[model samples]
Target: MATSTNGAPSMFSKSNYTWMLIGAVVIALGMFLMSGGKSADPNVFNRDAVYSTTRITVAPIIIFIGLAIEIYAIFKRSSPEKK
Candidate 1:
């Protein structure tokens, strides 16, 4: 059995970390999309801006997809490559 210099195996491979990073970026993007629906005027209310499809529908779907990717990344098994 192979072991590191400290005699402990790494919990995650490089690819796993990459996937996790990608998932995190996706989640951030989703959150960003959900934002920016505010009206410039304090007294004026814009229903369309607040209820836009991108913010109300697309953003939530993107967030859910990102969460799913993160979950998959956490459970994914890494197989060592043969040299």
Candidate 2:
């Protein structure tokens, strides 16, 4: 929608907000999978398994960062404050 004569666009637009929420959830799930929901085992001796676990261990932190970025984008797109 176009901005009102006063110059700021509506803050309640559904598209941007909806996409932001969807993106956050997708990121969370992706991170969970990356960390290995049911397949991760620390005791496995195979080289590939060991490497996978190592990557899995770092998934949460990466997810947190992704969440932060998504939130930041939402805030950045917020309507300008009226004076």
Candidate 3:
């Protein structure tokens, strides 16, 4: 094994990983909100259930917000350590 003198830093810091986790959770929440609300009878077509505001409107918006959070996390830089 060769001894190395140069110290290398990781691409992402702990805060970045935490932000990623938060974003992932938010996305999952959005997906969960969008999931089906099964009617008691499959034969009966429930337009209201199918196109509810939460699933159609709110969920997509939430997902977009999560995506934005993820983007922010990816671009955010940690402050350099003071000497």
Candidate 4:
């Protein structure tokens, strides 16, 4: 009997999907941080610390968006041409 080698294509694979999601989340976080400007709180711990932490939290969102774009491009490339 012949063994089946069928499997999901790279774009649709679990690993790829997970990575894409992670990337999107990263990018989103980055955007959030950049847009946050600086913490406006007058008495919450430290202003700079809060601002910096917010900025750091945003890095992932940027990364995630890039990954998602890449995945979209890959899928587009693999799609069959319409007759």
Cα displacement (angstroms), candidate 4, residue 26, comes to 0.5
Q: What is the lDDT of residue 28 in candidate 3?
A: 98
Model 3 regions more than 4 Å off: 1-7
Better-scoring candidate (TM-score), 1 or 2: 1
- lDDT-superior candidate, 2 or 3: 3
TM-score, structure 3 vs. true: 0.84
lDDT values, one for every candidate: 0.85, 0.61, 0.85, 0.55
lDDT of 3 by residue, 7-67 (tens): 5666666677789889999999999999997899989989999899999999999999999
Residue-pair clashes per candidate, as listed?
A: 0, 0, 0, 15
Over 1-83, each residue of candidate 1 has an lDDT whose tens digit, in order, gives 23457978877777777888988999999999999977889899899999999999999999998898888887888887566
* Better-scoring candidate (lDDT), 1 or 2: 1
Query: Estimated TM-score per prediction?
Result: 0.87, 0.39, 0.84, 0.37
Q: How far is candidate 3 from the true structure (C-alpha RMSD, Å)?
A: 4.9
- lDDT per residue for candidate 2 within 1-83, as digits (tens), equals 43666978665455556767776886777566575334455555565643675455566666776687677656655445456
Q: Flag regions of model 2 displaced more than 4 Å.
A: 1-12, 37-43, 53-69, 76-83
- Expressed as tens digits, the lDDT of each residue in 1-83 for candidate 4 is 11225743343444445556765766666666666444466555665664665456555556566767657644643334245
